[model samples]
Target: MSANKKNFQVPYTGVTKIQVGKKLGTSRLYIQTPSETYKFKFQFIKLEQVESSIRSFLPSSVLIESGQLD
Candidate 1:
């Protein structure tokens, strides 16, 4: 994950979009920024944990929903 961070920085302010999906059997969290979309694979972290962590940083106005990407 550290290696992927070199490509883009997560925004400190501004409304960001979040999505979750499964790719090739790996669960991933997708963060959509103004210019690019960042993907983070979670092998150990549960879906609920990820949602909670992201919610801590974002404002209540930013809706965080949990569902399978299909």
Candidate 2:
């Protein structure tokens, strides 16, 4: 499953790092910020572990202070 779409919003400043994840065959969205972590089970099989794997492929998609969409 090659998910080529990344939808999120990272605050301007005072932000550290952002993370998102979702399970297979599901549209749930999980977010993890510096202050807290949240789970959003939009619909379908929005399991935690599967979403964890989706998040597993994130680091490489991370961007710096260059406004790069990655």
Candidate 3:
């Protein structure tokens, strides 16, 4: 043990990947950051809405190049 000097308080600057899937009758969104991965679940919204919301948070250049993925 070298005294745990790593800082865990830094904010995520960008999102690297986004994935959407369904499980147990609920829709799930997976957001991959440099330091961590986040998951969100929704039961009412359509898949397109979920994707749009995620893209809204990302940089416009990324969306312009590839658009949203399935």
Candidate 4:
């Protein structure tokens, strides 16, 4: 049932206890995933904005999007 959006992935280490419900973030926003039952803090990623940029899913032909790839 895992979608595995593949937007961002962070490897889990021993210290990070994997559980079903946990929080992950660093100020901006925190997202909770249904399955962390063996994974730790994988990695912090702003996937939607970041991924969209990479995939060129923007409407502006000029791609004037700034602050991305920061």
> Which candidate achieves the best lDDT against the true structure?
1
Candidate 1 per-residue C-alpha lDDT over 1-70 given as tens digits, one digit per residue, 9 for 90 to 100? 5688576556556437787656565667887778776778888667767777778877777776456764
* Ranking of predictions according to TM-score: 1, 3, 2, 4
Provide the lDDT at 28 for model 1: 73
Candidate 3 residues lying further than 4 Å off, grouped into runs, are 1-13, 63-70
RMSD for each model, in Å, please?
3.9, 11.6, 7.2, 13.8
Error of 2 at 42 (Å): 1.2
Q: Per-residue lDDT for 1-70 in model 3, tens only?
A: 3467653332334766667766665667876778787667889887667777767866665431223334
**In model 1, how large is the Cα lDDT of residue 37?**
67
lDDT comparing candidate 3 with the true structure: 0.62
Show model 4 residue runs off by greater than 4 Å.
Answer: 1-45, 57-70
Q: Which candidate, 1 or 2, would have the higher lDDT against the true structure?
A: 1
Predicted model with the maximum TM-score? 1
The ten-residue window of minimal lDDT in model 3 covers: 61-70
In candidate 4, which residue pairs clash? 10-42
lDDT of 4 by residue, 1-70 (tens): 2477655553322123211222444212222234543222324545344334333632333222222121
Q: After best superposition, candidate 2 residue 67: deviation in angstroms?
A: 20
Distance from true location, Cα of 52 in model 4, Å: 0.1
Each model's TM-score?
0.64, 0.30, 0.55, 0.18
